[model samples]
Target: MGKLTIVAHIKAKADKIDLVKSELLKLINTTRAESGCINYNLHQDNSNPAHFLFYENWESRSLWQTHMNNKHLEDYMKATEGAVDEFVLNEMAEIDS
Candidate 1:
């Protein structure tokens, strides 16, 4: 199977940007340590402080699925409830060169 690439766009509620940022930051270390993780990076938009993005690469779709069901991720979802205004997650595969 091919590697899985994920692009996640997250928007924080105006009043809750700090809270959302903190929660998202907490995922970095843990996610990087997960099995089959190739890379997990987080970014903030220069033009919009409330806008955030994550770029993640995993060995396979099954590993990515494990990441989605991780306990820490579940806690993050609960903690960010209502603090996040929008979230879009996209999964992709690299095209052979």
Candidate 2:
């Protein structure tokens, strides 16, 4: 298996933006410390405060999967249950030139 790149977009409910952003921020430190995590960065849209993006790179898809199943992720889900309006995730392989 090769490196995996994940692009995740999260849009918070208008009224729940703060809550969702906090919960999403909580994932950073822990996720960055996880094995095989090369990088995990969070971004908020300049014009849209409720929009968030997570740009991540992992050593492998399996390790990324492991990270997905971690307790913190589950906690994040529980914490932001109804706070999110839209979520999209994309997994890709870097094209080598």
Candidate 3:
């Protein structure tokens, strides 16, 4: 099995930027501790404060799937219900070199 990479772009509603950011930040610590997590980093766009991106690497697709079902993620989903304006998730596999 090969490693998987995930690029997630999140945009918070204008009025809920702060609340959405706080909720997203909470996923960092917990996600980093999960099994098979190689690296999970979050970034905020300087020009657009409400725009955020997450770059993640996983040992395998299954492990990444497990992460999606994690309790904290579910909680985040619930907590940010309408606060998010757009969410784009992309999964990729490295090409043989």
TM, every model: 0.96, 0.97, 0.95
What are the per-residue Cα lDDT tens digits for candidate 3 across 3-42?
A: 9999999999999999999999999999999999999999
lDDT, model 2: 0.97
Best by TM-score: 2
- List candidate 1 segments past 4 Å from native: none
TM-score of 3: 0.95
* Best-matching candidate per lDDT: 2
Which digits, one per residue and each the tens of the lDDT, describe model 2 over residues 4-54?
Answer: 999999999999999999999999999999999999999999999999999
Any residue pairs clashing in model 1, and if so which? none
Supply the TM-score for candidate 2. 0.97
Q: What C-alpha lDDT, on a 0 to 100 scale, does residue 80 get in candidate 2?
A: 95
